[model samples]
Target: MIKECCNKIDNNKVLLSMAIKKKRYEALVQVYHSELYRFAYWLCHDPTIAEDLVQETFLRAWRSLESLQDDKAAKPWLLTILRRENARRFERKQFDYADVENNTLEDNKSVTLDDEMEQTVIHRQINKLSPEYREPLLLQVVMGCSGEEIADILELNKNTVMTRLYRARNQLKEALTDNHEPIKGALN
Candidate 1:
């Protein structure tokens, strides 16, 4: 399968040499948009911003669709675009620190009682992470992108991505364990 997809890339240029850019673009969007939006949502913690970011990423992808190599790498290739667009957004306005770090989880305690309690627990915990850690976590666990792909997307060394992913999950585990601290209640 890997060999077949690589064969499609007549040359090692994702943006330029693909046989049908339009068809590829459509396939890319259809295949990865949901994953991208989820990733962006986790990054921005806002669905509206996530939607806008995904749109911007796709538009940029269309404009420079030729730079991508290895159709298999499309997911992370698109992610690199989204992350850059996210960084550029800060130059437009001075966002408050609070905008990014959502520290008010304590205020939404009842949210843990929902039907999809496990999902809510996980998202709530994920939301609690700083973006530095969250981005790697989302890329690996959510988007299912590989270490090489994430390293490319974040422009970090692959080892750095691996370490960060480890720390991210470790932090998540600690946070979730800390959250389960109703010792007296449980003891009763």
Candidate 2:
């Protein structure tokens, strides 16, 4: 009778453990999936690949869920998983070089906002920035991560993250000003 009782208790403990894991995984999906997907998109510049990358990241996260000790560390943990997944894509295979001129993705269309065209210009300039500057900027601006979080995600020091962010904003400001100067000169 005591053995049966112990078995029941063990089964109950297993069930409870599974329930807690499910709850945590569900919460993670709800909170970080979109943000992770956006970061993946920015990294790869392909919507389909970005979706796949997020799926793989979450899959790996689930497999290693026990390694995650703190709730606060989840964001950086997930982002690190995602960055690794993106890097692995390059390691897997080498694709033939495609002609850049014929690529449809190169086509940029201008969208006017109150005759300003500011949004389109900014989007283009952001895309123009080097990946070193753009990645930190996107993580902070889009994901709303702190410098420490960004540093953890990017595997850099906190000071490096801050410095990159400052440089990114200054570069954007200068590039935008330079772009508009020609129009201002034409107007004059």
Task: Give the number of the best model, judged by lDDT.
Answer: 2
**What would you estimate as the lDDT of candidate 2?**
0.81
lDDT of 1 by residue, 82-186 (tens): 989889888786667565633222233454444345555677777778887888888897788888888888899999999998888888887766886432212
* Model 2 TM-score, 2 decimals: 0.79
Which residue pairs come into collision in candidate 1? Answer: 14-68, 15-65, 15-66, 15-67, 15-68, 16-66
In candidate 2, list every pair of residues with a backbone clash: none
- Give me the overall lDDT of model 1: 0.78
Highest TM-score: give the candidate number. 2
Per-candidate TM vs. native? 0.71, 0.79
